[model samples]
Target: MKNIYLLFGICLAAFLLNMALIKLAVDLPEFFTSHLNDLLCMPIVLSICLFIIRSFSRNKGIKISLFSACSLAALYSIYFELYLPDNSTRYTSDVIDVILYFSGAITFWLVQGMEAGRKSSAIKKAA
Candidate 1:
């Protein structure tokens, strides 16, 4: 779907920007590469995961459920906050990351709802 492709583009762009901010440039604010970096990709990753799960699922309605969004966010937060931190020294465990993950998940849910509403209106107009 177009939206999925767009999400991929956004994800790729964000990742590149994060990398550039952290590695290529020296004078840029650390917030962009450090604190905000964890926040930046959360929504994109969650959205992509939701889209993929929805596409593969037998129940199409599962895509719009808040549970799916929250579950994915929780899983992501646990992995990055707990498992990854324990396994690697590059990333440290932070409670704010979990909060950001929830924030991103909520944003994704709202966006998806709006997108669905738009599609519905378009279909009604076409009919």
Candidate 2:
């Protein structure tokens, strides 16, 4: 839980910094301007989803499942990268963004695993 919160905080902070840079008209590298949001999308989104799920469910220990996380990333990638670009002039398809979405998903999964590991370790210690 603490690991997820930390991950969420870091991602959220980076995201806010990116937004602040954009709003302030600060010139930044293309990666920061373009890909940072893509890289951050899933972890932040999934963390919020996990928070909601935990809030509503009887099981507070619930985390986003790997399959669900990857599936969402794939769906979001396709929607933003494939579908939107063809449908709207405002959106351009970027393959790199698709890769970043999956990377974010994997990051969330790894951090969530860390929290699980920590819980197990605590349980073992308590025993």
Candidate 3:
């Protein structure tokens, strides 16, 4: 369906952005904590996911992109956790980062769900 293509594009963009931001986190030697630094892509990815879901999904929930988003978040998080030079600088990948990734995905779902609900309600009122 048309929605699937949009979801795929969003996922691809999120993956690319996440990868780039991971590199940024690696090279940036700053005062910020690792958690804060690693969280840079949270909003971007979530926004992309949420936008695609809201525009594409007509259902009440984020069923269409749920598995894709969650799996991508998990696998991407694990990849970065293992490959990134976090340990050298004490930016170790704890369970919390994984949680953050999942949280980001869930947050995207919830926000889009709310948007969908509002749109449906508006349509009903207008009708």
Query: For this target, which candidate reaches the highest TM-score against the unseen true structure?
Result: 2
Query: The CA-based lDDT of model 3 is what?
Result: 0.58
lDDT of 1 at 76: 85
Those runs of model 1 whose alpha carbons end farther than 4 Å from true positions after fitting are 1-8, 50-64
Off by over 4 Å in 3: 1-32, 37-40, 49-64, 85-91
Q: Number of backbone collisions per candidate, in order?
A: 0, 0, 0
Cα distance off (Å), candidate 2, residue 82? 0.6
Root-mean-square deviation (CA) per prediction: 2.9, 0.8, 7.5
Per-residue error for 3 in candidate 3, Å, reads 19
TM-score sort, best first:
2, 1, 3
Compared with the true structure, all predictions reach lDDT values of: 0.72, 0.95, 0.58
TM-score (C-alpha) between model 2 and the true structure:
0.96
Candidate 3 versus the native: TM-score?
A: 0.53
- Between prediction 1 and prediction 3, which has the larger lDDT? 1
Model 3, 1-127: lDDT tens digits are 3343344356566556555776777563342334443343444565555557767878535543667667877776877776564556644667667777777566555555565678779899999
Best by lDDT: 2
TM-score of each: 0.73, 0.96, 0.53
Q: What would you estimate as the lDDT of candidate 2?
A: 0.95
Candidate 3 lDDT at 33 equals 37
Lowest summed lDDT over 10 consecutive residues: which window, candidate 2? 1-10
Ten-residue stretch with the least lDDT total in model 3: 28-37
